[model samples]
Target: MSDASRHLDARSWKALRDKSPEEVADFSTHLSQPCEVCEAFLERSDEDDAFGVESLADEALGSMSTPREDAVGWARLRRRLWTPRRAWLAGAVAVAAAAVVAIAVLPPVASKEHEDRSWRLKGVAPMSLELSAVARLPDGTLHAVTEDDLLPPEAVVLVRYRASEVSDAMLVLESPEGPAQMLGGYTLEAGTHDLKEAGELAGVSLAGEHGPRVLVLAAWPRGPRSAAARDAALTQRLVPEEAAQARLRLRVEPGYVAP
Candidate 1:
């Protein structure tokens, strides 16, 4: 064995290569890296190399009418050092060893695509939105709710939105008196904004007998609009058709529970 091989770290298998004569005896069980190990093993095997060389020399000699004149031993040394015999046997053994190691390390999670790339807590995969939005629970895990997804009475919801363009945005909620209640209004650009406390959304306490409600998010041009005009525009329902006519940008309606 070379001095570099014995003291190598097993943690880094890439550094391992087959260099020892004894390794060829048990090539199947060796811990050497697949690529370097097989190449090194075949290069060191004298019997296989000698047979290969003889076969190559025979083929060359048969093709030639006469041997080329060589005064020095340079051509002879070159022929001895370099020959193109395929070392498929060594490569096959190395691949088998690599497969065994991979199976041992990641056997349990290898078949599960989600488990392999997910966080410690189980994750929901529906957040692949173009305008990406999500709601987080109090425990910091993501909370995905439909009409079927229920939340606790005191569970603080975190509504997050990632804007894709520069525009003015507002998150509005339906007030108890039946007009549009603006929760937040800001000049937002292309970035993320996290709203942690979602009540009736107008700072109104939500412990009373209010049914399920939907929060509307509107994004428009960043020019001037009076409070009355903004209220007039927002007080009405922001359906898909109305938003399209106004040339409005993003209109996200993320609903929540106030029970």
Candidate 2:
């Protein structure tokens, strides 16, 4: 989870929502912790959180004596969240935008190796749908593991959603030569799916000469070849076979996938 999502819980959300967007920055610095409450808040049915966020935003907009846009990014966020066809506006937008608001005025931050691996902890994906790195253990069990997690030498890479609700999923693996289609015309119906098992494995191997690689997963109302997402970037114009696609990028470390 991002630093912002980890700390923001229901109480905090209400408190922050009551404040003007500009005041949100004051709450940002203290959001660093493993927060199950916030995770549950996000895990709730889509409509529940959406209504809460929108209601708060509506109230905020109503109370601001200042110009609406001048209230800060919240106003724009409110508009974006309510747009029809955006099913993911709840967890992704709320957590991400709130986090950014909290940290906007902060000083330059430093990076560390731990942060790279821990990105999966956010329990959220960056796209309208959800996508995360998955791997199989030596015992043949599957887990929603991230690149930061240790994988055995022979572990196979896979992808799955944050929840079963997000649908019409697709995947593409980027190579130095170009993009390789993994499972373009498919939708994930359940938990972890081995990339090799879900699609044709002919000549496909993340452990092959490519060394380590990047896995791109998309889940939207669209297919492998069409455009369904409002964000142009989410639309995979490159692949034009199935429906529209929105993507989240995940890295598989070279060493982890090495032979």
Candidate 3:
């Protein structure tokens, strides 16, 4: 893609959200050309009802007291909306509205530790689902990890998940070698849950080996399946067919230090 095309892709969501004449004009002009990627992005955005979520996010940010809060709120909202390859808009809207309320009422914290430990939305998937990961830094402070964030070596990562309904879930880590099962044959109750706090499992440590790793959460309806069955299914397909799956990709760059 050309530089201009890349810019258009990155700003397309913003244009739709802002509805400013200049952005809209630029977006429309780009659309007039024969670009399948842009066209598909627009279609997906429409399907996801990006405008409604954007408006909710704007209102939430407007209620915040500081630029820092606004930035954090917007970043969370963006990940919830735009990071997912596929999403159901109804659930997304509900989540956005809830976030608006949460952000509006939450008191500002002056401590960096408190601020850093705030739960961050890391990834989203279909079925109105989300996955969050937080790492305990060497200094004993908690840090919510994002796709772009570099995790410290041997960092202990805890996870929390949200689901619209009760389902069976499998957590897997995909590396260059193959898929390694982190947690499997587990049941996810409806709503948000902290895996470690719930005593389902402790936590997983990201290896010091540097590269990219993908955390995959595959969920399906409650059904009769044996451990062997689940493992076989995962081996054949990382994500089951017709199942809701969320993926968080994390990159570990050598000698990179977290700020």
Candidate 4:
């Protein structure tokens, strides 16, 4: 069992969600102990699920039209909804499917003006990394933001990443007005992760910032370096020759209002 004082990590939660018998038994045993932090984390995970489902439903409704687009949208929705613990979302899934079918008969809407601004650095490495950002609205909903979007001053920006291999990762923020700031260090286990959920930092706030800012994800194979060494490498904009890295460039315009 993990330390009672520590909350469960993403891999453990993923295993539990996937109905791994050992993981479920272990988590159940852990919860039987006195751990307020894990309990609070459980509650927050449930809340995040609810909010995530609603946002995905809205996205499916808005984006589905042609058969190809419908397939893509439904695939994404199913990936989120069909998790073992999320069986309760069956009803929601049916409703979303019905709505998608209804919309499929309509003519396709034009694509949005904003292009996909997210990109990976061109390189050959053992792992691949991708970075995306979403804004947490005041209502606790999330809106995916791209480079073309002008973020609101008070927006809570949550960074999400996808990695192709298990690695040690660091998130660094570079602003035109300041030096590179290390947001947090993380151990990414070969999948997509929301930095807020996976790390101690709640979320990145762009409240007082402006102009183009770069968020960098530098990741190398795990277990080879100390935290101090990782920090030092990032300070010099250097990584191991085998590291995988990605960057997201964002602009914060304080006066611009996001819809």
In lDDT terms, which candidate is top? 4
lDDT of 3 by residue, 27-142 (tens): 66666778878656654664446557557877899978754536457546744753322111211112211221100111112344434422211122335456766655557556
The deviation in Å at residue 201 for candidate 2 is 14
Error of 3 at 174 (Å): 1.0
- For candidate 3, the clash count comes to 0
Q: Is candidate 2 or candidate 4 better by TM-score?
A: 4
Residue 138's lDDT in candidate 4: 52
Q: Of 2 and 3, which scores higher on TM-score?
A: 3
Q: What is the C-alpha RMSD of each candidate to the true structure, in Å?
A: 29.6, 25.3, 23.4, 21.8
TM-score (C-alpha, index-matched) for candidate 2: 0.31
Best by TM-score: 4
Predicted structure 4: clash tally: 0
Report clash pairs, candidate 3.
Answer: none
Worst 10 residues of 1 by lDDT: 99-108
What is the C-alpha local distance difference test score of candidate 1?
A: 0.34
- The regions of model 1 sitting more than 4 angstroms off are 1-142, 146-148, 175-178, 195-209, 224-259
Error of model 4, residue 8, in angstroms = 54
In order of TM-score, best first, we have 4, 3, 2, 1
Candidate 2 Cα outliers beyond 4 Å, as residue runs: 1-127, 138-144, 147-153, 163-166, 188-205, 222-259
Clashing pairs in 1: 18-37
Candidate 2 local Cα displacement, residue 29, angstroms: 91
